[model samples]
Target: MTATLASVPVRSRSFAFILGSPRSGGNTETLARYAAEGLPPDSTSGWLNLCDLPLPAQPAGPVPSGAEKVLLDATLESTDIVVASPLHWYSVSAATKLYLDYWARWIALPDVSFRERMRGKNLWAVTAYARGDDRDTEPLTGMLRRTADYLAMEWRGALLARAHRPGDLEADPAILSRAAGFFDPRD
Candidate 1:
């Protein structure tokens, strides 16, 4: 994946790296963890693995709270947001997909400000597939980009890693460095 970002003037840059793989030790999670290693020292950053959260179905309230709220808040508060997931048959993992589905509910809230709040943030993605071909990830990337467009966020590209098994990314020093450098402002 290319390591680049939109040339926007970030007032207070921050990154929220999210992991949506079902396996806590999955390659997607590994890459995301390593990628966040290079975040600017002064930037606010956090990593949330969605596999650990409970996606309960509930109607929206005045102030959305809990995991969904935390994630939405982080996505809004940060200048950049990284969404990482393992491609599950040309689509994001179930957890990631479901988390995104919450956007629908959030937008329907009584005092919904979800769309307005998400405007202009940079949305990045990190995904992996056993196929070892970037082509397999195109659909996912397109979905992410379209989602960003729909939310009025910016699509800042993606890291499409190749992993045949767990810990594969850890074995490639060059890829590991590139992954981490995604967040490195110094390049």
Candidate 2:
């Protein structure tokens, strides 16, 4: 059964959009932008697109780059974070996963911990899949939930939609409405 979003609460929310698409104007980014539009203007929003900021593969013991640190800090400090990605093999896209994997550096450091940085933060996952079946999303949802749990963040909710082609989500009213409702600050 499709879950209802009426119970979700939003107040003084700051959002960070972890966009996973290699292309800047892809469906996932578009959907994320749409969701962010519903938030109050006072709320801070940051967009961290992996394609735009590619980190080295598994840096040897936290190769701290000022730009990456700034982006990561902004995401960690946000009150609300929306992880938006296109599905890859029924899971988060590699681009997004790579960004997430970098979190390991923070958690592994002796002085810094993900729990300390992310505690009490609200987390949301927005996934776009070509397949229409809800079952296809279970693994992705579980992965996201586990990530949130590890960071001691609140798993606010998820917004799942299907996009078979470019701009498909925009043409689908049901999916658009559901997404808007799920991410709506007033809802």
- Highest lDDT: which candidate? 1
Mark the regions of model 2 whose C-alpha exceeds 4 Å error after superposition: 1-11, 60-63
Over 1-187, each residue of candidate 1 has an lDDT whose tens digit, in order, gives 6545675555668888878988887888788778777777878877888866656656356667777677777766778888899999998988888888888877776575878888888899998788858898988999999999999898988887899797789788888878877875763
> What global local distance difference test value does model 2 have?
0.78
Determine the backbone clash count of candidate 2: 0
lDDT of each: 0.81, 0.78
lDDT of model 1 at position 125: 93
The parts of candidate 1 lying over 4 Å away from their true place are: 1-10, 57-63
Candidate 2: deviation at residue 14, Å? 1.6
Candidate 2 lDDT tens digits, 96-173:
787778777767766656668788888898877787677798888899899889888889777887787887987899
RMSD of each: 6.1, 6.9
Model 1: colliding residue pairs: none
- For model 2, what is the error of residue 90's alpha carbon versus the real structure, in angstroms, after optimal superposition? 1.1
